[model samples]
Target: TTGNISFRNETTFGGSGTVTYRWLVNNVQVATSTDLNYNFTVPTGATMPYMFTVKLEASNIVGCKTVQEKTVQFNPFPRALFNVVQARGCAPFNLQIGNQSTNADQYEWYLDGTLVSTLHSPNNIVLNDFDRTYTLRLLVKNQYGCIQDEQSVQVSTYPYLKAEFDVANDLSCNGILDVQITNRSVGATTYTWDYGDGSPVYVGNNPSHSYGRQGVFTLKLTASNGFCSDIFTKTVSVSNTPSASFTSNVRSGCNQLIVRFRNTSINATEYLWDFGDGAFSREENPEHQYAFANTAFTVKLTVVNQYGCRDEVSATNFIAVSPPPQANIEVAPARVIKVPNYSFTFKAVTTDDIILYRWDFGDGTSSDRSEVTHKYDRFGTYKVKLFITNRNNCTSVIEEEVI
Candidate 1:
């Protein structure tokens, strides 16, 4: 008669009766009991005069019942709460951490996939490194010795990406280093590349690249769907190759001019020369003789590479030629008639250039006076125009009149 009631109950039998029980808290009915234990939450207060009363009732065949009440003290201690603050870095070094419950008793840590440590305070903690998974958890026990729930997340990191290689040092080549890519994100599904050569190049691990010119480069690595990326730069030393030189000259002799071409291409296999004289020749060293006087000239060279690639260069050159004297003109038909038309002949003689001539008839019409005739449509008085040019580019002109 002085204890809390429960279902699995034991009591001393006194009289013949049907036994049942109902429980109440804060003076309100909450549960029915037929055994020793009765379920009910204690009214919330430690100092308050809260009570849990167990009732014993008895009934006989006469339909008459009698009851008695018993009560005991009900008290429960408050529970403590614990949580994790942050988890970072790789396993073993995962550094599992959490804040201790203000009145807590102990701490524990798990990393990657395993539990490794238990401590008494909220200090820095390291977890197990034996697992390959990227997630880990923390555990804390309150003053009442209650364990905390688990917390986890996935991390992206690569510890194997250390690089090693040498630089390229070629004059005619793109100066790229012999570097390599390594898959350090353990258990990664795929790999990507950015060779820092102006484009995103994709290849498997240990990939190599060549640059277009000479300079420093910034290389980058992005792995695991861009989950992690790293950048580093390196300077490459490159040198310039000197270009070969070419020179051509012209010399004059009796009735002939000799043209000469030369160069300093030790790597070239063949050379072509365009003398600008409407003539061309192919040889390492070339010589051409011309009987014509000095004229405008352009000397060209086509240097053929070992790979058959050719580069052509041309230089303009001028020559000094002797000009012939101008010829004297003679009018054959000194007089002519026609109010509206006249015809006459004119001639000139030049010993050096006989085929080159100009004619100036007394009429207003004229022609190259080598031995030319002209007619004037309106001939009251007329003046003529004559022009002549020789192969040496020497020119002579004459004008005449008739009435």
Candidate 2:
């Protein structure tokens, strides 16, 4: 800071004996001289824009004196200094600021080249957006219209981590439970997985796992970005399957055959038996009867478990039924001599076990014999009919002519 002084000297006499000048600041004399030029510098560490009362005194040898006074104002430049409470944090971060400026009448703040606050001391600034870096600037201006250099600070932000996942092949059959896990987390660098089967923990973005047993299980996933971590969980269900098998007591018999079935299935709660002969049963052990002879029947057994898993077993030609015997007869003399009495010998031909037979000569005569000799009184023509029955109560009939 600099100040200047100007003074004029006057004398009544043309030739002056002596002329003296005196200058004082704030009512204190500091210089005495004959020269008209006066200059001084302000002291350091003094208050800015200081006011001073400067006086100039002029004296001649005749003792004539004059005095002049003026007031001068001095101002200094401002100093800018500040600090941020926190420079780096996660999103939605709050930052406290401190202003330590000197000789400043107003303050202005800028963030990322945009003005944010103008107060001398601003409130806490919150940054809720994600960015790699942010620039904060502060400007201080003094009453002298002099502005300080811009002061700046840099703040860093870390990315937020989220955990999410999905499961594939969750439902399985035949007691084989295999699952594929997919990770859907964002802004993560590492992952950890828990399958919830008392097994070892796994670490990966995607993985496949097999369960030793069947039931419901819970899975967990954790993701981290070295600064923040998040977790997610899900529930999965597994089903148990059953094995079906069966046995039968009788495989082949005569018509109207009765067969007993035994069910042999594992992990089953319900059963269904289908006998190929248009018969169905729900009993674990059931009895079925076949009515058609000379026919083969297929048997099927299906079992279901508590988890709604099912299995089936089938046997082709599991049961066979046979028909009763058929009877036929042949006579040695089909046509006997047309005399008063003729005798014919008849023999029974059969394919099955016959227990009883009845023979009629068609001439009002009958006999019960497998092989017999029949005598006909009238010899024009005679029809012989035979009926036979098997041990199973199945019967057959045949007719022959004797002439």
Question: Considering every candidate listed, which one attains the maximal TM-score?
Answer: 2
The 0-to-1 C-alpha lDDT of every candidate, in the order given, reads: 0.51, 0.81
Query: Which portions of model 1 show Cα errors greater than 4 Å?
Result: 1-40, 43-107, 110-191, 205-207, 222-403
Q: After superposition, how far is residue 277 of candidate 1 from its true place, in Å?
A: 62
43: Cα error in model 2, Å = 4.6
lDDT per residue (tens digit) for residues 22-51 in model 2 = 878788887785545657568876766878
Q: TM-scores, in order shown?
A: 0.28, 0.42
lDDT of 1: 0.51
Error of 2 at 70 (Å): 2.0
Clashes of 1: 12
In candidate 2, position 294 carries an lDDT of 84
RMSD of each: 16.4, 18.9
Q: Write the per-residue lDDT of candidate 1 for residues 212-316, one digit (tens) a residue.
A: 655445555444433333333344333222234476574333235665656765445677777766877877887776555535565667776543345666666
Candidate 2 error regions (>4 Å):
1-19, 33-49, 123-131, 159-182, 191-223, 228-403
